[model samples]
Target: MVRPLAVDVDGTLTRPKPDRGVDPRVFEALRAYSEEAPVVVATGKAFPYPVALCEFVGLPIRVVAENGGVVCIEQGDGDDPYGGGRFGDGVVYNGDREAADAVARAYEAEGHALGWGAVDLVNRWRETEIAVARDQPLAPLERVAAAHGQEVVDTGYAYHVKSPDVDKDIGLETAADRLGYGPGDFLAVGDSENDAEMFGVAGESWAVANADDAALSAADFVTDAAYADGFLEALERATE
Candidate 1:
């Protein structure tokens, strides 16, 4: 059985779209899961974004942000109440800042606005990952990555330009380091292309019913429900 459950925020727990809120029931499920084992939220989202979600859940869990480039374990008010702030519990990997900047410039050159829409919140704070627009206009972005020897991936909400050497699985592995979790000890849940990396690496990965065909094909398990409901359903089974 998995010791820590790695969850994806947007399509997996949220409304399957960016800037959406999580259902209160979803938080309930997360709390329940936390009671059994460590819980980790792994997403392409930036820092405080993860912080915001943790605040909402009110359950301290580790955050693997920026598609695994940045990881933070919440500092509990006191008492080490949640078993957070442990594990490889810190920012594990960040791509070259120069590479991130160049990718940002490339997005602009391709006529994509860098500081607009869903990516606005993370634009300034993401020092290591180049997160720009979503998949609608991403072929050029991939080309830019190829030119720069970088990697570009879509999270359904946004396309991220990050270090090719680092992926969600890499970040997830860092979180698993202290907990005696090999990839075989993880049960990851996600619903987008960015999630594919973790799906392949985790012991067992579940793609929510709402996930695209590619994502579903990548996972070891596929849920019948969508969004947070799908996640909660999987949570129940994983714990059982």
Candidate 2:
């Protein structure tokens, strides 16, 4: 069987900002690959987003959402998330949402907006961790988050404030266990700092050409292309 594929969303599957959505060129290849091995779409995105992506991408709903705060692996036949599915190991949660929220509150009290503005859907469904818009001043948010016993992580798209104990690796560990595999059995690919922890755990890891410093440092290899092209390149290399 093919090794499990753990991939990021934003900059890994899609193009950078000013461009959006997973590139159509990857759809066929990704779906084909998923037929041979589980494709875990891991990201700092909220749970629903990745779940929906899995649905539309024609892959089973295996995702590490909210930067490792939420993990869902489709095992057995029950598809309802709120019903029998929650009874077993179908879903798992980590991180401290309350602590992260406190950081957001304190940061706003210091006269800084959360930066996404009102009706910010980016974080509307996020169940764990706090995602601040990347345009916000990072240093001040970092200071406020630290005071509240939280840490800030830059994923290029946003600044995530979360518990130091939680990260993508933690999420992957949960996923791997539930799927009857180990962390080292997976091949990971991504392009941001949020993916750094995951890169460190996978048996093999690739940072896209445009990856941030953290991811580049953590990954075992770096693809020659950026964005979705880099993802395709990594996928090809893995299967080759």
Candidate No. with top TM-score: 2
TM-score for all models, in order of appearance? 0.86, 0.94
Candidate 2: tens digits of C-alpha lDDT, residues 88-191: 56568898888988998899998898788779887788888989987888999999988988899898888999898899999999998888899999999999
Highest lDDT model number: 2
Q: Give the per-residue Cα lDDT of candidate 1 at 118.
A: 57
Q: RMSD for each model, in Å, please?
A: 3.2, 2.1
Tally clashing residue pairs in candidate 1: 0
lDDT of 1 by residue, 104-213 (tens): 78767888765467546667787578776653467777888778878887677777888888888787887777455676688899998878888888888899998977
lDDT of each: 0.76, 0.87
On the 0 to 100 scale, the lDDT of residue 23 in model 2 is 89
Query: Alpha-carbon error at 216 in model 1, in Å?
Result: 0.8
Alpha-carbon runs more than 4 Å astray in model 1: 16-19, 74-89, 115-119
